[model samples]
Target chain A: MEIPDKSATAPDFAEPPVFAEPWHAELFAMTVHLHKQGLFSWLDWTAQLSEALAAAGKHHTLDGGDDYYAVWLDTLLQIMIAQGVTDDSSVQAMQEQWRNAYVRTPHGKPVRLADDGAD
Target chain B: MPHEHDDHNAHSLLPSEPALRVRALETILTRKGLVSAETLDEIIDVYAHKIGPHIGAKIVARAWIDSDFKQALLTNAESILGEMKLAGRQGEHVQVVENTANIHNMVVCTLCSCYPWPLLGIPPSWYKSDAYRKRAVREPRAVLAEFGITPSQTQSVRVWDSTAEMRYLVLPMMPVAAAGCDEATLARWVTRDCMVGTGIPKAPQI
Candidate 1:
């Protein structure tokens, strides 16, 4: 089959490279850190991710953006909970703590759980 | 894009849901002494700056100028990369497929984004796009066309599906115009897309 010349077409390549947001990188690093800490094996991690992707696939097409990373985060949480590393309540509590910290944090100041009187 | 609103203020006082979740997870992990913040920051820094397409470019450039290295790369990329201290994490197993006059190779992770991150860093957003993952295999020519890459009729397109077990990198053919160029000069011509097979290395400008 003769492929037509389509060199003139220009697709935008100016989009954010690698991580679009700080949290994406943070979430990714945390997963890797846990794996390195023997919390879960890489094989286990990939399996969980694959399962998450399959589950997500049932809803809609994954854009591999926030939706994809959301699945990634879910996989991390699932593995962590399954491994007895942490549970839903603790994660929720920490999330609430962070929410409060960030809300009260002044602009350009670092948000920390310590600042919010939560350890 | 779901993150369009957050884009307006990267440092917004109101953190997004994902941001909060990440922070929560980090705190939980840190409190238990399971992980450290410094290590997390180091890992992120490595991916953001230390590792990327430029590393792959150097490998590709060396292969272009050195026949022995090229042969070694195609046969056992993982070991060659390991010898260079570039093999680890997502790059545990890698295969380098060469582009020739008769064959062209492209890569896609139809299941999820299983790229050789140690070499290419995090994949470009488009590589993970639903449209790309679905179409790249079903209609490679058309998808490549969208990337402005139209392989000639005589050159067959072969799409390699990347997975957690195996990853593939396309060793683009050195442009004829780049003859006699040094490795550094040759590396400059190779882009991330070239290694991914979505686009070819740019011809050197005279």
Candidate 2:
């Protein structure tokens, strides 16, 4: 199957476009999905994110880059942990697994949990 | 999990840490049946294709032609937008501020990038930039000038700070050259910057 070139069709704007990276869009979609699943209310999500931003603001400027979404990812984890949806250890372990999987997968291939099992 | 790497070149292909982290989170959540990949794809598709400034422009065009809609939009935008099936998620609470002869309105989120996503899609990078967030509230006129909009000295600039609680969309004044034009034509003149108060619709050439 052939994939269309998204960059070729994207509109040119004076400034950088939102969702500069695919993961940014994925993170946003996951938050919305989790919110829709009754994991947390939108208000709660915003409050937690607001608090996270406030805390991060003290240490560095929020430039809406990886750092901004890093705070978002942290806020999401914090909420999930606080709500007993998932524990810190499990997430950490899973992250380690993914890191290993990513390191084993070849270039331009999708990283999968099964790839981690090859070891 | 082992830390052994079979492919040395794979290290160079590793995505950013946050990228890997998000992928892990999604994988865990999906395995636990908390989130469906299809739903995630649907949401991303909607934002990337279906939603954008074009929707907001259509609404603004209707307001430009209809006095009653303009009044209803300003008075109670949430319900009005809900009626149009445009109310959701980031647009739960909305306020439409009008630009007139005497007053000019601009929006920024001092806390974070809180915007009316259903109407405007994802915000522009500049909107979420540190410089814009800090300067927009401090000196809106100068910021507007940077966007090539120099609101006359007679006009008072009102900078609204958006929060997750409420989002603001600027209703730019219709250009004189657009008089008697249809709603579609008027909408063509309304750009994302116009709705964000950084730019105004230029007069359409006949």
Counted clashes in each candidate structure: 0, 0
Off by over 4 Å in 1: A1-15, A114-119, B1-12, B204-206
Model 2 stretches astray by more than 4 angstroms:
A1-17, A115-119, B1-7, B10-12, B203-206
Q: How far does residue A37 in candidate 2 sit from its true spot (Å)?
A: 1.8
DockQ of 2: 0.34
Candidate 1, chain A: TM-score against the reference: 0.78
Docking class of 2: acceptable
True-contact fraction per candidate equals: 0.51, 0.48
Candidate 2 lDDT by residue in tens digits, A1-119: 22233432233234354578888889899998888877777778888887788788788777777778889899998888888878888888878888777686677776677644332
Model 2 chain A: lowest-lDDT 10 consecutive positions: A1-10
List of clashing residue pairs for candidate 2? none
In the range B1-206, model 1's lDDT, one tens digit per residue, is 45544343444288788788888988888878987878989999988777788788888989998999999999988889899987868425899999999999999988777888877889977787778888999999999999899899999999999877888999999998777777766776788898999999885333
- Native-to-model Cα distance after best TM-score fit, residue B125 in candidate 1, in Å: 1.6
